[model samples]
Target: MNQFIWSFLCGLGEAKYLNRTFVMDLNMCLSGAHTEDGKDVNGKDFRFYFDFEHLKESVPLVEEGDFLKDWHRWDKKKGPGRMTVRKVPTYKVTPMQLKRDKSNIIWRQFDGKEPENYWYRVCEGRAAKVIQRPWYAIWKSKRLMNIVTEIAGRMDWDYDGLHVIRGWKAQNKKMYPNLDADTSPDAIVSKVTKLIKEWRNLYIATNEPFYYYFDKLRSHYHVHLLDDYKELWSNTSEWYNETTAITGGKPVPFDAYMKVIVDTEVFYRSKAKVETFNNLTRDCKDGINTCNL
Candidate 1:
């Protein structure tokens, strides 16, 4: 079940033309980025939306033809008005959902009954490849995740200014639906503990430079897979800054994440990576305060 299931290309809209490559690996850092091809913004209506896959030709229009107009802007010939230029999301347009504007794209988002299982699919695969495992496979494992559930109740992280934790239902959707979190405490203690230990060993042997963690915009907790991006463009301090802003600079935000309620974590970078791990069951241990290595 730990195998690459599905993936999408990483490049789009950045170029005169988008260059995309499918994620063959499951363990790699990935984020869902939306394009303004024709998608609606909050309180703002739009003509349509299209997935970048459908983007081929560029259309023409007035001063602000598209939201890109602002970033790729031109001065209006004559107009006394301040307008908002939010790009439309044409990338997600379905054949049936085109032309007509959607009711809303921004909603109180959650993993719901299903966590798109896309959760970390791209990340794991990339990580597998990084470790020189050419035939790596990654998928939502209701089985292993069940292991997490029974033992910890949930695994959470701080993402894009949001506090995120997986509950039974949300984690279920993210896991293999047919399976359930290992309900028995003993099972979690035995099986789940073992896997983590083994994975840790394998990871240590690789001696990777840095492990990057990006909260999926939509799905998956991608561990940056490419050799080029072992660490994030920003450092641990930058991440702390972002988390602080998300929580309005609350003093105990990091503590909250590491404590029982929040359960947030980041992978270790080279020097930051350590063989020592503090068991949550333990009163305390070293490196618990460290962010992504």
Candidate 2:
């Protein structure tokens, strides 16, 4: 998801540089790490996870499907050789060079391997100085933000946040030897007591699968997790209804990625945010013994 966001930003920067309408692919693929079954899933609507309406307002853009439809329509009408297109097969051909081409279409093909195929590669080296990725252009889906608002509203918009990064990191004794022990319920309660007042609403943003993992903290604070507000994304909810309508009536699963997105956003709204690496544990985020770097 981070890679896709950066790549899209690079593309948007290129379009801005050339003063051309940015053609966006509405259909996106979810990485295996973000999926429920740990497998990549394609055909996910861009609007399902992002604010496309907001993006339209931010940049000169058109949906890929709509753009291709118009392209084919024009081709059929004019027969042949009427439209001008410059097919750029490599990132080595910089955007600066194509600034005044006046081509109808500047199609960039990223068909190479590894680092070569990355879309953001166009913004590297000297081009990086000129093409500024408009990070402000991309916004989270309003539907997801609605869920974040609902979760915050449940706590009356007054709460402290705890981000406990456990899961595999805790299990890996080599790198994060103390992560599991540090993030244990008893450890959490002991450490959080000093930072957050007792009985205060504590919204724990964690990857811990066990629901009862944070039960110890409940004794001192009103513990809240992403699962606590499952109804917001459940079948009977507004999110379900709206997303289904977009996907030809197919139900969209509130997968792991969506959970993380909501959890992080909700955490951001907290009056006091306590992070795992920053507060709960001394372990480095990337791994052990690399904190100075």
Candidate 3:
């Protein structure tokens, strides 16, 4: 059964905000590489997330209606959006779980069992709006994109790239024991040697700050990191300073986020890719190496 599903908007949190890029990338891969869905997932998702149908005060981009305000005022905020007959009763699925999955039904059927045929009631309305549109799209910062593009283009898209995601996970030895052990600078350097030949261009994307960690790769391959383009992304850059001001000192680490986004995009467009383990598949992760594009 082919059921058309529409995703519901949940509040943006730390992990979800980052994870959505992967989802959008997956959708892009499903469609093809070097192409985008051309939709802004962040804007559309959050617009619904922040919709205040109950309040008299206007929320940006949401429709204004007297009845919506009156109904909510009388009912004392029964729900966030209009209710539909489609009540998919799920148990033990917390808001956090929903946030992680982004309302995709496929993630629930990972045990080799056939997934049930169900559709979101919301899809009926939104389906028309998204006609001829791709499944997912990402919202990327333009300034960051421009800078990263210029830097990535220097390699002429002819390089093998590595995505080394070592930061909190690597530091926390107890919680993610296997991940921590395998992602150490020593382990990464040892493993990546077999993946790349000497004299190849190697682009690395990592949260680790130790410039010396990549010395081995640098010796073998023409190494590139964010530090290579310090003039554009470094804290001293005027663009970075101005962005911080416009963000009003946002509590979140915006600069770190820019690196992650830029790195993900650049690596996605690379000639070949590699990443940390995918225990479930016993491989180097699906989206990283096998983009199927």
Q: Of 2 and 3, which scores higher on lDDT?
A: 2
lDDT by residue for model 2 over 49-147, one digit each (tens)? Answer: 789998999999999989999998777756456678899999899999999898889999999998899899999999999998988888999999999
TM-score of 2: 0.95
How many pairs of residues collide in each model? 44, 0, 0
Q: How big is the RMSD of model 3?
A: 13.5
Candidate 2 regions exceeding 4 Å error are 77-81
Per-residue lDDT, model 2, residue 270, is 98
Quote each prediction's TM-score. 0.23, 0.95, 0.48
RMSD of model 1 against the true structure = 18.6
lDDT of 1 by residue, 74-179 (tens): 3343364433232323323221222243321111112434334332322243332322221222221222223223223211321111121213322343332311
Residue 84's lDDT in candidate 2: 81
Scored by lDDT, model 3 comes in at 0.48
lDDT of 2: 0.91
- How does candidate 1 score on lDDT? 0.24
True-structure RMSD, every candidate? 18.6, 1.6, 13.5
In model 3, the Cα lDDT at residue 82 comes to 34
Task: Write the residue-wise lDDT of candidate 3 on 1-293 in tens digits.
Answer: 01211332221121133243111111101111111333322312121111122211311122324434654665563565533222235322333334434331213211222332221322234333322222232234465667767877898878888887665555544544456567665666777777667678888877677877778667678998877777774577655665566456432233444566677778777776777653211233323234343
- The TM-score, computed over Cα atoms with residue i paired to residue i, of candidate 1 is 0.23
